[model samples]
Target: MLITISSLLNQTELAETRDALETVEWSDGAKTAGRTARNVKQNRQADLSGSRGQALHELLLRKISGHPVLQAAARPAKFSRLLISETADHGGYGDHTDNALMGRGAARIRTDLSFTLFLSEPARYEGGELVIDMPGYTQAVKPDAGDLVLYPSGTIHQVAPVTKGTRIACVGWLQSLIRDAACREILFDMENLRASLRASLPQGSRELLTLDKSIANLVRLWAET
Candidate 1:
């Protein structure tokens, strides 16, 4: 499921988040990396923690609680973890698979989706493009401050180094209701079809009702509770 959900956060929310992040204490980029991750991750960066991360976490929950796209992608997911905090000053993660284990017990799960919430405008930084490696696609995304980019968790991706200024973004993982990526892809396609069908139908038409029911049933059967 190679998907991109852009502009996930509105301008007002982005402003608040940016303000909050500015005050958070940051550490050496090297300290945030795991033993295995050290070889790949480089540049000056830090993780969100303590009161600062807690406030940001709560804020994000409130903001995303009613988001339709997020709701659809993260079905059955009660909440998402603010697993990684990124503050870049010519900082960025190198090319690496996030699937590796951290400690003896700590490890990555079947994360269905990944998200990057941009906290800086394009003009504020140089480079720092998110490079995602798909089967046949290598995408470079550098969206606006309030915009977001969501994609599959399995794809290998990295952040291009910032040449000047700074780049701040929030990264997280989603444990979707439908754990299988293929299943999620099918559901997403079906939902798209359902929307298209509804738009083409006349109000109170028989076809609309029938298609709606079918769609509902599919969601009911496949969706995780």
Candidate 2:
């Protein structure tokens, strides 16, 4: 399952972050792709390990780390620093799965979650929609500024070519505590239902107790630990 969260950051924060992004040095992305996206990949990506883009990378990472929904879905035991990408001239990310290898000689760690935070306004781009292939549902999302899109890292997904201006965004990977999508979906639904019940029920209502118990048991049944 994929989740879209809007307005992950305020206008002032977005502006400051965008300004910071301009200072980071960008490099060609063609080497990362083969033929499909290579022909259309004209933008630059900030080097996460380099010293020049440290500040901007840190800021974006901080924001994502504190997000409630992302935290719930990612269930991240560990996360990588933020990486920025600026795509233009029909810019798009070709279909590619994240590499599971971690450090120089550490045990292989799976990439359980993937996130894309939109840094540009929706009107600025033409066709840079995110396409995710699900079992029966095909999700196409192009969210507004400061919005975020999260999905399973195992899924084969791609970014549609951007025909107009540039598409700027931040991307990151997460190693989740619970990696099963089915279990994650069930937990996410329970959390949403819990919120809804809280809003509709009076304080100390008997129904609230029943709902709480249901949620607790579900968590016990599905929790990875």
Candidate 3:
């Protein structure tokens, strides 16, 4: 299930992240791409080992961890290292799926979902749309700065080449506790319904209690860990 979380980062946080990015050094992004994908990937990636890069990574993790909608939709169990990608001068990634697993040994994470957090404003770049090929249709995404797009990692997707200014985004993959995308979608819908009912119904309403029980039971049945 594909979902979008608008304004994942506040203005002040976005400004700070953009400022820090300006001072960090970047390297070839293909270095980390899968063997087949490396042939078509053309972009730059920030060195995460650098102080500024590490700080940005931490900030993003904190924000994502606290987001209620994201928590409900993703149910993330483990995450791969974040990638700060910059594309310009016709650079773009060709159609390819993310690796099934990332990291090694105890740190390994099975990628079930992928996300892109936009850092550059839409007006700051031309093209560079994140295009995903769905079963029956294709979707091209280009959200405003601070927005995010989350989709299944197995989808065939690509970054359309940037024709004008630079495009910067934070990309990552995660292993969901609820491994089935359909199950995750159902849970997300239930969570939204529960929240709405909670706001309108009295505390401990029977309908709300029933929904809570069903959701909990479903999670218990579907959750991996």
Candidate 4:
């Protein structure tokens, strides 16, 4: 399911990250792209193995781990490294899907969902909308700073080139505990309904119990070991 979580980073945290990224060294983004994706990726990325990169990763992980909305939607089993990317000089990535598998050996993660945590304000950039092709429609997502959009890993997506100013974002992927997207979608909907029903109906109502049980069963059916 395609979803946008807002205020992922508080005002203070967002400002701190933006300040740090202003002077952070960046390398060619193509270095990490797959063979075909590399041809169209023209942005710059931070050295993900460096000290600054590690710090960014830790900070993001801590924040993500505590986000209830992200926890419900992503159900992340393992998260990949945070890639701080910037686009300027009319730079951006063309349509491409992320690698199915990331890392190696014991640290391997199967990408089930992809997320782009936008740090640049919408007004700061001219034309760098994140376009994701869904089943029958194309969604152009250009969230405000401190917001993030998450989509299925296999979706065909691309970043429109920046025309006027620089666009900065932290991109990453995660392997979800619930492998099936449809199943997770159902659980998410059920949980949301459960919350609403709890407030509208009595706590011990039969409707709540039935929905809560259904959610448990779906989680059991979809959750991966």
Candidate 5:
């Protein structure tokens, strides 16, 4: 499921972080890329172990991970550091999938979901669409600033080149509590229903109660921990 959630960061957060992102020093993106993936990787990423990079990681996790829509869709167990990537003239990431695992020992995480949070406005860049390859068609997404696109970790995807202006985004990987993609989709749908019904239906209404019960049961059955 390819899901795009808007306003993952509010204006205040975007305003603050955009400046931070602009000032941070970056490293070659190939530093984290695998052998095969490095061949096609041509962008740059923030050195996330630094002070400002750490701040961006914490900020994104607090805002995006806590979002209601993202929580419903991802059911995340752990999040990697928010990786800030930029593409300048003739720069872009070629088709590749994220790593199956990240971190070591106690912090090891299985990547079930991958996400890209746009930090720059679309108008600022020329051709930096997030091109995701689906079964029969390719989906190109160039969302507004503060919007995030989430997809399965194993999907074949690429970032198109930025010809005119630089393109910057915060990307991350997550481990979902529910590992099965189909089960996660069902839970996501049910969770959305639960949220909507809570507002429209009366408190403790039979309809609301029933839906809540279903959601709880599904989560209990599917959740990893």
Candidate 6:
């Protein structure tokens, strides 16, 4: 399942992030990519080891974790360090899947889902679309600044070449409590239904209670941790 969350960051937060990004130094993104991916990954990445990078990472993490829709869709158990990447002058990544596991030793996490939070407006760049090979058809994504797109990490995907200007985004992966994507989709639908029902139904209504029970039981049956 692919999910898009519009305006994940507000205008003020977006401005703060963009301003901070301007001051950070960038390096070849291939240095962090897997061996095979390194061959096709052509972009610049902000040095996450610096103070500014760490602060930006923390700020985005807080925003993502606090979002209700993301929580319902991902059910994230653990997260990888956010990558602030910039692509310009035809730089792009070829089709490749993310590493199944990320980090080392105690911090390692299985990448069940991947996400990209666009930091630059679409109008500022040209031809930098996130192309994903879906089950039957391929999808090209280009969302507004501050929007986020979430998809399964195992899918073959690529960043289309940026012919003009620049494309900057914060990319990351997460290990979800529910490993199965279909299960997560079902639960997400149920959660939305529950939210809608809550607005119209009386408190402690039997229908609401039954739905709550069903969702909880499914989580018990499917959750990895």
Query: Tens-digit lDDT track for model 1 on 1-225?
Result: 455566777888888787777777666665655576667676654345678767887777565545676666555354445543554566677886555222223333456677777778889889889899988979999988766677777788888987787787777666677767677767677677766777787867887788677767777777675
- Per-residue error for 15 in candidate 6, Å, reads 0.8
Model 2, 99-152: lDDT tens digits are 553423343456778889999998998988888887788788889989999987
**How many clashes show up in model 4?**
0
- Each model's total of backbone clashes: 0, 0, 0, 0, 0, 0
Residue pair clashes in candidate 5:
none
Per-residue lDDT value at 144 in model 1: 84
Per-residue CA lDDT of model 3 for 1-225, tens digit only, reads 788899999899999999988889899999999999999999999987888788888999888766888899999999888889999999999999999999999789999999999999999999999999888999999999999999999999999999999999999988999999999999999999998998899988899999989999999999998
Give per-residue CA lDDT, model 5, range 80-172, as digits (tens): 767888888889999998899998887889999999999889999899999998778889999999999999888899999889898989888
Off by over 4 Å in 5: none
- Compared with the true structure, the alpha-carbon lDDT of candidate 1 equals 0.69
User: Which scores higher on lDDT, 4 or 6?
Assistant: 6
Per-candidate TM-scores read: 0.81, 0.83, 0.98, 0.94, 0.96, 0.98
On residues 1-225, what C-alpha lDDT tens digit does candidate 6 reach at each position? 998999999899999999898888899999999999999999999986789878988999999877899999999999888999999999999989999999998789999999999999999999999999989999999999999999999999999999999999999999999998999999999999999999999989999999999999999999998
Superposed Cα deviation of residue 116, candidate 3 (Å): 0.2
Quantify all predictions' global Cα lDDT against the true fold. Answer: 0.69, 0.76, 0.93, 0.88, 0.89, 0.94
lDDT of 4 by residue, 57-133 (tens): 78877886668888888888998877889998899899999899998887789999999999889999899999999
lDDT of 4: 0.88
Q: Residue 146's C-alpha lDDT in candidate 6?
A: 96
Q: Give the C-alpha lDDT of model 3.
A: 0.93
Descending-lDDT candidate ranking = 6, 3, 5, 4, 2, 1
Angstrom error at residue 178, model 1: 1.3
Q: Which whole-number lDDT from 0 to 100 does residue 141 have in model 1?
A: 91
For candidate 2, the 10 contiguous residues with the lowest summed lDDT are 99-108
